[model samples]
Target: MATNVLICDDSSFARKQMARAIPKEWEVDIHFAGDGVEGVQAIREGKGEVVFLDLTMPNLDGYGVLETIRKEDLPAMVIVVSGDIQPDAQDRVKKLGAMAFIKKPIDAEKAREVLTEYGILTGA
Candidate 1:
């Protein structure tokens, strides 16, 4: 079965980059959101079994989405992809229930490694 994946970012370029970084062997139905508000909505709609979230967005932001997911006990696994490389930022996201964080200009290998290590991506 193809997994549902959401890439939420304010940047169209970033979204496309994220889409490309996903392993070609993995079967996924990719969804795009321009901001965090849309991202959360997509998650609630079951379009986001695994979410690639951005830290800085216009309507809600990644942290807010994470908080909402935690508060609602949402069943999606969130991986934050951001340009914010601060250690505090990474730590904060993890604390907020993100499975992992990948810095901006995402590397396909690193993303795959993280997903595989966390057992989120399999047989890809």
Candidate 2:
């Protein structure tokens, strides 16, 4: 079965880059959301089994999305992809419930490693 994946970022370029990093072998139905509000809505609509989220967005932001997910007990795994590489930012997202944080201009190898670590993707 194909996994439902959501990439939520304000930058269209960032979204495309993130999309490209997803392993070719992974079966997924990818969805795009321009901001957190749309991201949350997409999650609720079951378009986001796994979410690649950007921290700085208009309206809700990544932290707000995490809070919404936690508060609502939403069933989605979040991996924050952001230019914010601050340790405090990473800790905050981890505390808020993100599976991991990938520094922006995401690397395909790193993405694959994270996915493999979390058992979201299998095989070598």
Candidate 3:
């Protein structure tokens, strides 16, 4: 089965960049969300399994998305992709149930590494 992957970011450029960064090994039906509200809605509509979420956005931020995911007990693994590389930001996301965090602009290789570590991708 193809994985349903959601890339949520405010920047259209960043969204496209993230879509390209997903490891080709992952057979995914990619979805895009312009903000956290859309991201949450996409997850509810059953398009979220693995999520690439951006920290800064309009309507809502990644943290709010994380909060809603945890609060509503959404069955999605969130991976934060953000320009905010603060230790506090990382810790907060993890605490809120993100599987991993990747800094922007993302390096495809490093993304693969993190995905592999999280078992979202096998090191094949």
- Which model scores highest in lDDT? 2
C-alpha lDDT of residue 60 in model 1? 95
TM-score of each: 0.97, 0.98, 0.96
Q: Rate the local accuracy (lDDT) of all candidates.
A: 0.94, 0.97, 0.93
lDDT of 3 by residue, 2-121 (tens): 899999999999999999988887889999999999999999998999999999999999999999999999999999999999999999999999999999998999899998888888
For residues 15-88, what per-residue lDDT tens digits would candidate 1 score against the true structure?
Answer: 99999999988889999999988998999999999999999999799999999999988889999999999999
Ranking by lDDT: 2, 1, 3
**Ranking 2 against 3 by lDDT, winner:** 2
- Which whole-number lDDT from 0 to 100 does residue 80 have in model 1? 97
Weakest 10 consecutive residues of candidate 3 by summed lDDT: 115-124
How many pairs of residues in model 2 come into backbone collision? 0
Candidate 2 lDDT for residue 1:
89
Off by over 4 Å in 2: none
